[model samples]
Target: MDQTNDTAETLTPQTVRHSILWRVIFYFATASIALSIVVSAALVVWNYEQQTEAFRERLEDIRVGYSESLGSSLWFYDEIQIQSQVKGIMNLEAISYVRVTDNLNINIEVGTRPHHSDIETLPIEFNGKPIGVLEIAFDRDAVIAKASRAAISTMIAQLVSLLLLASMLGVVVHTLINRRISEMAAQVNDRLSSNQYSPLAISTGKDKDEIDLLIQAFNALSEQMIDQLEQKTQAQQQLKTINLELEDRVKERTHNLQKTVDELNQTLAELHATQGKLIEAEKLSSLGGMVAGIAHEINTPLGLCITIHSYINDNYQVMKRAFDGGGMRKQDFVDFMGMMDESLGILDKNLQRAAHLIKSFKQVSEDQTGEHIRRFSLHDYLHEIMETLSPKFKQTQHKVEIDCSENLWMETFAGSISQVVTNLVMNSLVHAFEHTKEGLIRIQAAEEKGNIVIRYTDNGCGLSAEAKHKIFEPFYTTKRGQGGTGLGMHLVYNIVHQRLKGEIQVEEADQGAAFRMVIPKITEESNVQ
Candidate 1:
């Protein structure tokens, strides 16, 4: 019998113990009951306080009414009116007693005075002067009785409503939440006790409650765990096989990477060399254009000189032949001399102009190519630059003006400075005054606060907002298809900011674009490559 009892106890499935649903239901019931009780008590207390406040407000109204009436009665010295006012205050439910006294030693009392300590005194005033004193006492018993009745009624109603709410809630919880949770817990326990990896067999209805969602999640987790275990076993077998070739694969990849790095280094070096050559080629191309312009400019003066010389030679020959033939009179001789003198003067002027042009061209060309630091007068240097660039503007109506201080000098990279100024002037001619017939470029330089400020302004079509923003960026041009290289302003920026250690900015202009460059004047020793 003892063995049979033990077997039966074991077969009971350990009582399938899971009381979380009951415990949760009980917890909710306890919380609901506690909340209801607290709310009921609070309502009762609030209602009581509100009733007491209403009683006090009633007493205040009676006191004020009596005071006003007594003030008029006492001022008129009417005893009957004063007594009538006191009796009216005593008629108030909360007013237990009313007393009135005056400066004339008159005293009046009404109603049964209360033993409560709550009392208020008011002085009747007539034209800002106290005429009498009115004392009013409130009946605490009546106020308490009314407040208690309201509180008791509220408590009873709250209790009944709370009881009905708790009962409904308990029924809903037990039927909808607790029972479903208990069934889920029993299925989970059975699965756990049997060490079964299969999903929960609990079926769900169309409503799909929380318990159904929990079962779905548990089933998905079970499937995922089974898949992971199989994957782990396969991964272990694959890992052993991969370890055999990992070292060799690593060596092969490292070798390939090293080869790729070597090729990259070679390509990088080639690119660097190519960049240097390109920059040099660009410089040479600029110089070639400058030389062609100078040559064209020099041809005009040289040709003029040759023409004058030929005319003077012909005039001399004719005068000589006339004299040799003995047909030269004094008048002829004087006219011939005068003509000779005029021809000589013209010849000299053309030759001198040609010489000056050649000199200016030489100086500018040397300064652009020398790459040397030199102390030079800024005013004279600017004039030389303008003169060298004169041929470019000679055909056009555009004019170049320089306004540099006479004493302003700098010991800096003249070659870079020459290139910068060349770029600026050329940029203006190409972009700034593209459609304009008449334009003006003003270049001004001054020394201020130990820095040279050079302002360049052009009275051509002012830069658009977009053009101004991207003007100094390389290879960015509005006239790209028109053979614009777009490197002019970029080179200028580099020379001014990088080579000369300067800063440049574009200033706002009304009808043109203005650029201001600030470069520090340093000694030759301080100038570095």
Candidate 2:
């Protein structure tokens, strides 16, 4: 029972609030309209009855008076006569109707327009049986006019009273309910504001109404929410402690990470230094070997020069000794001159060879000057590189063929091109001639695709796949321990990419490796230096 009461109480606010006033309006408005209609109909009927009764009473009086005196009988007439009669009746302020009837059931009302939808036939007791039936149609318009006036007055009064009463009652109910609810809610809010997690103790007592049930359920829900909020608060406090610990851990780890990064940077610097040293050492070793061979090769020319000088000195000494010893002769003098002439020729040839060697070396290592812009024959440039590297080629059965070209370039960086060509040729000699002999090198240049492509191809051993991949990496060399400087190809890559601002690539062929370099053509604006 309590549960059912509680359930009903809980639902009352939703159900009763809507049903009450609408229900009142439904009952009151419907009853009022119906009562007014019924009252109007009854009043109309009563007025009609009174009019008929009064007329019948007057007829009775007239009959008695006629019996006592002397008068004729009365009868209805045609429409004109009935109108005259009705006008007289209306002047007398009596609502009446006249009708003309015969012995048959036919009835003709004595009026221009008769609006009565219902007409009753009754026996006239004048002579006993009905001689002729006369139905006095009631004047309903007048009665309805009075009734409608009464209804309007009643409607206005009812509407005003309903409005005032409903407002007053609604105010009283709403104020009482709101005051009680507000008081209880304020207590709950006070508890909530103080601790924010306090339990609600909304007292519902025993008379559990709708508000009581609502407060009970809300208090339960609020208590549950308060419990969850308390748990969340405790969890947040614990999380704050964990967050502080995590901050310390993060700081510690960040310091360690920073230390590791610093150490890695230092180690990288040292490694770069070591690599630079190793590359320099390898270059120096290759240079030393080349220098020794060049020295030995130049020794021949120097020896020739020395021999020429020595022979001339010896001849002079011999002439002096012979002349002092009284052995001077014209034939001997001619022979000595011939020998001197031969020595001169020999000295000139050897000295020229040594000078050529020196010149080639200087060209290979000379730094580019000024803006590094110049113009020269592409054929000559290619030929010069071939001449410079010809020594290494001479050691083997390999030979490079150059296609002679006329003045071609209008602007270029000569030193950078030289380095690229030098590296390409050196790469070919070092890597391509692994296990073969009688190799061939071809240096070809042509105008292609708005640029010049200088392709240095070889018919020696082709590039291995691994060598092709690592060929451009700095300090990466296939001949890592085999006296390779490794900086040669790196320098070539840089000169082509960075110095000339062009591009160079390599491809291993069936019998050799090919290096293709593409550079922009010179314009007319470039100086022909």
Candidate 3:
């Protein structure tokens, strides 16, 4: 008896409800309840809108019919008639209260207005003049009660119908599927536990429904399982062979990967060495061009000096001959002295010009070769560099303008600065003015917030998007074969980024290429290195 009681307690309502048939019925009932609630809410809203519309129509009727009578009563000062007319309006549909107010300060209110009533007011006019106002308050609770009763009836009917349908559906599902499923479950459990593979058997008619198909599938699966059991030993051997082959392949691949990594490392070291050599070659190439330009510039002045020397020598021979022959006079000596003065002055001027050109060339060459820090005016250095580079521009119609403040001075490594400017100027001359005549290159410098901002621009053919992107890359040049080494701008980039520790960027321009560089007034040696 105690065991029976414990068994009954275990099959409690909660456990019993977990059955599939019960769950299907419960879900249907919940859906029916939710749908009923939604329908009821919609029905209530529709009824309220209709009721409110009817209430508005009746209010309009009261306004048109009662305004004139109420106005006549107030104009005649008839208190009894005003009360009678207001009571008449209150008797209309849904109107709970009426109030009449006249110009004479007579206010008459009648009927009881609930807290939730809607009120409307109308002006009372007689003979085209306003006499008083009529207010009507309508009761909404009675209408709401009617709509609620109708909605409740509808919800009850739907809930009953849905529950009946849900019960029938649950019974059908249990009879058609649940009983056969239970039998199949028992057969599968028996086969799994006892290691006896066998087809499940359940009685079925000739209809070939879902249960018949499920039985066929189960029988086929049982035959496949038996075949798998027979091949289990062979499958284990095959798996071992596959794993060994995979291990060998992995070892071979790992060895090859290591070899490839070593090769890559060696290649990278070689590339760095080659790049350093190329950079040195590029610097030397720029220095060689500067030397050639200076030589060409110095030749003209030296040639003039030679010519002047010969002319003075010839004149000295003439004067010495006249003195030695005893034919020299005071006027003749004065004439010879004046001629010597003029010739010597011309010789001295040419010599001084040649000396100045050589001095500027030497200074630029020294800065280009090594790093040297010296306080110098930016304006003077630009003119000096331009003087040395004048040979390249002097032959062309192109002009170079420098716009640096004379007071701006820097005490940093001038070599890098000189290299960067020289490269940029050369780059513009070579690439920027390819097809244009009278091109203008402008270099502007200013000191802002302890940094030197330099803007280099040219009024010539601008750089294409591709060229601008790879301009600083080594061995990248538009004029590949026309004496372009393709390392000028690359060297410039290295000098700015690695030597000066500055930033350079390409900017937009109207008719040409524009580049902006911002260099710090003082740079740390560690940062530069």
Candidate 4:
């Protein structure tokens, strides 16, 4: 018997002891009862008030009628008619008493007199003259009793109807929702207890209720879990197979990776050498351009000088022939002397100008190529550099101005300084004023606290924010593919910072680009390289 009991307990589906349908019914019944009580009490109070008001009005009407009847009877001295009206008023169910009185000493009364609290009085008149007063009392208890009965009957009806509604609702809820939910809960418990992953058998037909939907979702989730488990098992097998081949693949991959690394190292070395060659080529190209410009400038003056010298030589020959033939008159001699003086003056001035230009160019070119460290006047050196670059701007409206203290001198890398200044000026010509015809470049230098500060500014299109950020970065150029190797500014940056031991920075300008360079007048002992 004990074994049978245990088996039964095991097979029985676990369910909640309390029924949801009963709980819902109980709550609904409680609310209905509460509402009924409230409505019943309200109705009782309201009926009581209404009945009391009606009774008061009826009592008032009785008093008015009695006053009129008694007024006429007193005027005619008809005692019997007055008595009849008083008796009729007293006969009403809510009327407790009635009285008639007047100033002429006439008086009448009927029934037992009610207390003053229940009595009300009305004045009577006859032909615009005072005749009598009529008073009546109402039975308050009787009126309240009628209202209470009506309220009680309404309450009973509401309670009965509510009970029936609650019963019907409980039956429907249990049949349609509660029983199905209980069955679903039992099935879910059974699956959980037995660790079963089988899909639940639930109807998902045209009338798809919430319970049916929940069951369908649970079943789908079970199927998905089963599929995932199968996939996991298959993946484990595949992982084992992959592990078996991993060693061979690793060996092959390592060999390929080493080969790739070697190739990358070789490519990197080649790239470094190529970059060096490119930089050198850029420098040569710049020097070639300078040489071309200088030649062109020199040719102009040289050609003019040649023509003037030839003209003077031909005049001298003509004068020599005239003198030899004794045909030189005083006026002709004076004219010839004046022409000779003018020619000599022109020749001397042209030769001096050409010589000065060549000297400046030679000095600047030598300084740039020699990399000599020498004590030089900053102002004079800057002038020479500008002279060398003048040919580039001779055809344009751009002007270059240099301002430096005359006594300020520095023993430093003259070549690097030349390179730095040349790159900056060239950058302005190529990039800063690419669109503008007329521009002004100003270079101001001064010695400050044993350091030289050079401020360079140009009244041209200024560098854009992006350009300013990357202007000194190697191989970054806005004029790519147009003879811009992008090394000019980079070289400037390197020469100034690395070679000259100076720092250069871009600064805000009113109308164009500005740069500030601070270089030590005397190099540090350890940083001489």
Candidate 5:
């Protein structure tokens, strides 16, 4: 039982052939051998029939011999003689024995009740007419006796022939079908042994027979497996590449964002630093211009003082020595006192000039730093600021004109207002004065619609349409690098709008530019909610 179990368990593909291949080869070969055996047996039986017919013809000849015998022919009643005559005529050697029979029951035979052991009738004809029946028993007993022996020998030969044919058939069948299987097996084994499976080239047979069908199926299976494996591998590789690319792109975008943030921060710092520099620059520029103007204003007065002092000194010394000598009379004394009065008058006149200079300087200084917001004369503020900016106006031949309503009470930032005025005047003198030799700056302050409207316009170099549009944005300037900070108008805009709490506007003039500040008068407090 265990051995049976082991035999059953031992069957595997490696150990045995595929059932389909085996079944096809088995059925094909079985059909071929079975058909051959059937045809051979049919031929043997057909030959046996022909041999049996030959035996009947020989029996007919024996019957004809019996009929033609002289004694047996007409009214022959001697049975023994008839039989002897029949035997004498057919005196051929292979006859084992002979017998005769009459129409009556009287018959005699040399053999016995069963001489031949197998007897049968043969037709007897005379002149094409059935006369009687002739029973010629060919010596089947002796034939059987010999045939049994021959049959045994023939069977042995046939068995040998069948064995030889079967051996050859089995060899041919195995070579045709089984050999193909072995070849396919080798291919399968080779595919397994070698590691190269991708785009595996599976081999197949040209014939579409049973064995070739199996190989075709196996080749197809192998090719399919290779295709699926390659597709899966390519998908995995593509997935890996996509993931790597996504990671790289994310990192690159993050780095770029960080860099952008750093750049923006740096730009803010630069803007703040630039603002500081601009403030200091405007201050220093204003101070230098103020010094130049003050010095110019003082020059004439100081020159006059120096001349008066020298005149008094010269006259006082000469008159003092003459009066001390006493060679002069009372009239000489009167003349001396008169000269002293003239010298004192000259000193007094020069002293008045110096006093006027000091007063104007004081007023301008006070206006520059004044923080108090009050109702002051618009005309007075314009004159003081313009006179303080005289040196710059002198540098560029710009004439500043003041047109005032003579009484406009506008409450606003005074220091910033002065600064705005100073910047505007300088902008005209410096930036707008391309035609400086013929430049004219007009400042007009009037009460219009319950508001104080101040228009500062210049006729020197007109602003282009494009330049007028962005004049107030910081760092936007038409002048490229000639000390044009572009912050002047921006500062003016901020002060006019926020510090003074007023509306300011600008427009392109035919010759230069015009700036307007429309400030609400103190009286317009009721107009605001």
Candidate 6:
């Protein structure tokens, strides 16, 4: 008894409600009810239309049948007969009211008027002359009620037939499919509880159907799942062991890598510091070379001035002695005046030349040393750079030509430009024109598309492909041991790009290495310095 009670308790409301048999019945019943409602509605509407049309035809028939009789009665003043015909029309179920009226004072109405009805009026004429009119009102409610009754009967019959069919289908489905599915589910539950996977053994009928196929497929899937689960379990164990070893190895490797990274970072920082010092040293070295060149240049003019001064002093002494002894002839005095004029003229010219050289040296040296942004004539600045570097080329037959518009002006770091131009000239004299006697260097500047374009070219032994490629790399010198610091072109590249905020490229040239640069006429506001 307790076991039976337990069984009943196990079959909970959820299970009973979700039974396959009941579910199928509910679905079929719902579909049947919906279908009956739609069909019944259509039938009711059709019947109402048919009935309404028939009643209209009946009204016409009654009017036709009674028209001649009523007309004759009206002609003979037979009021009682007209009254009788209207009363008969009221007896028909669809007719709610009837009225007859004549032109000769015969008027009769029968039956009470309904609230909702359709009224039809017939004109009565005798021999093509209007006599009276017959009116009939149809009861809309009565027509609807008749159609509904007929539809209800048909719908009831159809519902009974559909429900019976639904019941039969539900039974067939339960016997064929639901029972086997329930057994399969029970077997699955049993297997789960036992922790043992096996093939499902639900009985199939004599001929195999979808149920048999489903059982076979489930058995095959169960076998595959079991094999996969076993393999997964073994793999998990192996992975656990491997993961421990991998974790230790990762820890060791991470420590070693971090130490190496620290060393590299230290090395890189030192390298950067060294590189900065080298660059500063390179700049200072270039300035020192310029100073040496300018010193040599000033000596020429100063030496000439010294010789002229000595010559003028001797002439002055002779004149003084002639005047003191009273032996100074007029011709001697005139010749002395002429010598004095010529000597003084030579002294004054030499002094001016020395002064001019000094001024050019001062400006170029200041520009090379100080980072000052100034507006200057591009052509004149290039010439000043060449003049300062003239002594370097004095012994050689190399010459630099400047081709720039005098009106082209720039507002930029003139010091960086001076450094770049000086470096390029020195590089040409040292490397480009090393073997050539008469080397020509051309510096061209022009305003193009709102930018100052400078093209520096030298007609010497042009750079090889490899040299050209690495020309601007710091510490990469073609003349490695012969006083080549390798930073000349690198400095030019950095100045043009960094300080001047411009772009420089090695252009294809026929006879020399050509460097083309495009710098903004006015530096960008952010890079004004």
| lDDT for each residue of candidate 5 in 1-529, tens digit (9 for 90 to 100) | 5554454344434677355455655665576566656655555565455556767776666665566553234244655566666566346533444555445564444443344345665544445544444444455455554545555555556656665666676677677766665665555545454543432243444666776676666667778988988899999999999999999999999999999999999999998898868865765677567777778866776787788678767776776787688566678668767876876787677777567556655665665556455666667766767666665655555577889866655665556667788888877776778556878889988888877888999887777776678888887777767767787788788777766678888865666788888876662333322
Model 1 lDDT per residue over 93-120, tens place? 6678888888897788887766646657
Clashes of each: 0, 1, 0, 0, 2, 0
Quality of model 3 by C-alpha lDDT: 0.84
Segments of candidate 3 deviating more than 4 angstroms: 1-240, 320-327
Give the per-residue lDDT digits (tens) of candidate 2, residues 244-304: 9999999999999999999999999999898778655644554454556566767889998
Candidate 5 wrongly placed segments (more than 4 Å): 1-248, 327-357, 366-375, 393-398, 473-484, 520-529
Residue 491 displacement (Å), model 3: 1.9
Compared with the true structure, all predictions reach lDDT values of 0.78, 0.65, 0.84, 0.82, 0.66, 0.84
Comparing 1 with 3 on lDDT, the higher-scoring candidate is 3
Per-candidate Cα RMSD to the true structure, in Å, reads 14.2, 14.6, 14.5, 10.4, 28.3, 7.7
How far in Å is the alpha carbon of 380 misplaced in model 5? Answer: 1.4
In the range 33-59, model 3's lDDT, one tens digit per residue, is 999999998888888788889989987
**Comparison by lDDT, 2 against 5, better one:** 5
Cα miss at 282, model 5 (Å)? 1.7
TM-score of each candidate? Answer: 0.53, 0.51, 0.59, 0.56, 0.47, 0.65
Q: Estimate the overall C-alpha local distance difference test score of candidate 1.
A: 0.78
Which stretches of model 6 miss by more than 4 angstroms? 1-27, 56-93, 113-117, 121-134, 164-218, 237-281, 306-337, 355-387, 392-417, 424-486, 493-529
Candidate 3 lDDT trough over 10 residues, lowest sum: 8-17
lDDT of 1 at 127: 75
Instruction: Report how far off residue 397 is in candidate 2 (Å).
Output: 1.0
Q: How many clashes (backbone atoms < 3 Å, residues ≥3 apart in a chain or on different chains) does model 1 have?
A: 0
